[model samples]
Target: MSTFTLDELVRVLRESAGEEEGVDLEGDILDVPFDDLGYDSLALLNTVIGIQQAVGVTLPDDIVSQELTPRLLLDLVNGHIARPAAGKA
Candidate 1:
């Protein structure tokens, strides 16, 4: 099974869109809202795309809006990664 960690998310976020000024992604940001982290909708959307490319997962279109925090996003992605495809089992 594939696993997506907070560190990976930070890396993908930086790769997709450079970190905002004065924001420390290395700190405890799991619960912090994306807005508080200086990330807008567009930035998050790009990060989602990056995650998709990096993890080979097809996330839902509404994921960006649905998962506001990093922890939430991690949960959603990991859940998707752990689930088996339809008709396989």
Candidate 2:
């Protein structure tokens, strides 16, 4: 299983929704809220879609609304990736 790293998240975020001016995504932003990073719910939703496409994971529909920070989101995505799909175990 491929681990979803912060770098990948940053890339998807930038691709789905352009970063805010003066906001450095390369910085330590794992705990930073998406709003503080100039990302609204819509941007996050788009990013979630992008991640699902890239990582081939079926995240929950409310994932974006639930995971507000990169760390939390990463944990959730990685958890999904680590677990086997239904009936596969």
Candidate 3:
């Protein structure tokens, strides 16, 4: 399983949105959704894809379908790590 951190996710998210300043995401960003952060689904999808590739987590293409919070993303990745689908690495 890959060791992807929430902090790294936040960094990638910020960078993906071309936001380098004034995006205070220091504390519990786990509960914050992408829309609340003023980001669209594309940004969230990009972030999810980046994290999936970085961590090798087998995430579905529509991972942003649900709430799409940091905690949800982490949980999904952890679930995939625990039990990957058959015939899938």
Candidate 4:
């Protein structure tokens, strides 16, 4: 399974946020508040969809309401994305 480290996650977030290159994705992502990440609610939803597309997994329903910090997001994504699908019981 593919796993996104905090660094890769920050890079994707930076791109999704429309940040310019040469900017520090980690520092910038950590510093900016989620509301000021340059994306609106819909845009944030789109970003979530994009992550699902790239990672081949769907996040939980409450993802948007939670995970306001980079570290929290990393944990959520890592934990959920790595979880096994419900089947084969």
The C-alpha lDDT values of all candidates are 0.86, 0.87, 0.71, 0.60
What TM-score do all the candidates reach, one by one? 0.89, 0.89, 0.76, 0.64
> What ranking of all candidate models by TM-score puts the best one first?
2, 1, 3, 4
- TM-score: the better of candidates 1 and 3: 1
RMSD to native, candidate 3:
2.9
Candidate 4 C-alpha lDDT tens digits along 16-50: 65664455555656545455554556556666666
Q: Which stretches of candidate 3 lie over 4 Å from their true place?
A: 20-22, 86-89
For model 2, how big is the CA root-mean-square deviation?
A: 2.7
Order of all candidates by lDDT, from best down to worst? Answer: 2, 1, 3, 4
Winner on TM-score (1 vs 4): 1
Candidate 2 clashing pairs, residues 3+ apart or interchain: none
lDDT per residue, candidate 2, 62-83, as tens digits? Answer: 8776348999999888988988
Instruction: List model 1 lDDT by residue over 66-88, tens digit each.
Output: 34999999998887788735213
Better of 2 and 3 by lDDT: 2
What TM-score does structure 4 among the candidates reach? 0.64
Worst 10 residues of 1 by lDDT: 80-89
